[model samples]
Target: MNDLERQSRILGVLTERPFASVRDLQIQVGVSGATIRRDIEKLHEAGRARKVYGGVAALDGLPPRAAALPFFENRDIAVAQKRDIARAAAAIVRDGSLIIVHGGSTCFQFGCEIAHRNVRVFTNSLPLAGYLGEHGTCQLTVGGGDLHREPGILYDTSGAGHTFYAAQFFVGALGISAEGLLEQHPLLVRFTAEMGRLANEIVVLVDSRKFTARPPTVTLPLSRIGRLITDSDLSDEHARMLEDEGVDYIIAPRGGEA
Candidate 1:
């Protein structure tokens, strides 16, 4: 690629991932070592990004926030596994059921799946609101709250105000720690807990990777979760925990796995 074209593309990658290594940029842009280095220098000169020991990162220095990537890019990252979990989750929706969707990429995918179904969706997620509002006939009610620009979610008093009703609520966690379903913010715990209590059922959509690590705050106890839908990579111990808590668990078959 020409120098201009290469520099522009490097800036774009830095904007998206924010923290990437030289190897990361090379892999992403499919350019040579020299090309990647030159592009990084150009970006640094433009004050768009800074180069670290092994890679380049956003000039802002913060990690790439969830909102930095639009809904579709987030969706495509774990395309097959998320779709499998989403499809399994979607099958549980009944006609005209009132569903509450928490804000996250996985849950947003579930929202996309259920949007075509005969259901009314209430969400605190900005992306889900946009997705369903555009493609579905279902009535969309977005919770009022302070917008969480990092994650594109609403998790404040305004978000919690709509908790008095809903047939089922779906949430995605940052990670599932041994402590329970975890998130990074205490406000998220309050909002998820309230919505979980209000809904008749609570479904936690987590891929297998979430089970191995934990985030900062507890979003729910296992007992509060009606079901856990994840990929087959879940360890037997974690699976046993869900079962012991009486949380119904569904493991979607991975690609080429039984």
Candidate 2:
């Protein structure tokens, strides 16, 4: 990985878990001890992380100020569910198809699951793009825009200069209710909606817990979503809701269950 990529990974690790040993960072980034140390030094110099005895820690007083949950914070929540959903989503992907994977923790897992597939992927998640650029065999394209550090997303406010399109668009949401797919931020709503328009099909990836969330902004209506892939834990009531909206749904089995 390049210096900028390494530094981003280091900072991402610190964001998820306050402290990380040099050894851990080395293993995760697949770099040498010397390289990890150099990246940590850069982060420390920038006042982004605290360089200590044998590792680095996130800055003490300044927590992320994002209105919505940051990528790191959402990454580990509903881990099993997210993995199962990703597996299901990956199963539906054709080997040579082109798709768009949007930013969010759940979609990040989906991106990783399909990293080695013989397909083309366009993504806006920095972490996902970085991971795929390093490990994926598929063609990868990142959207051009300013970065949203908290969500790890890149979005262009003016929505100009994008001529990309795909057969499918995979995305996650803050919540889903009768109204439609929901998000906590207006930019997310705008950008996600724009991406949906460029795709032939929209697939929603969310854990069952999101059914209970009631975020403020609606990104897309159920009518627009072509399909929904969620964990088996989803209640029959929500399944019926999707049915009522004429949306096809897939229930991904949990760990070890068939």
**Top TM-score model:** 2
| Model 1 agreement with the true structure over 116-209: per-residue lDDT tens digits | 7878888888888987888888888888878877668776663435535788899988677556798766666777888887898899998875
- Clashes per candidate (backbone, < 3 Å): 2, 0
Candidate 2 collision pairs: none
Clashing pairs in 1: 21-55, 22-55
Q: Judging by lDDT against the true structure, name the best candidate.
A: 2
What TM-scores do the predictions have?
Answer: 0.70, 0.73
Q: Which runs of model 2 end up more than 4 angstroms from their true locations?
A: 1-67, 256-258
Model 1, position 90: C-alpha lDDT score: 86
| lDDT against the true structure, each candidate | 0.74, 0.85
Candidate 2 lDDT over residue span 1-258, tens digit each: 799999998988877766677777878999998898898899999998878545676885853222255677567556788999999999889899999999998999999999999999999899999999998888999987899898898987675966867999999998898899988877778879888998999999998867866778889999999999999889999889888889899999887266
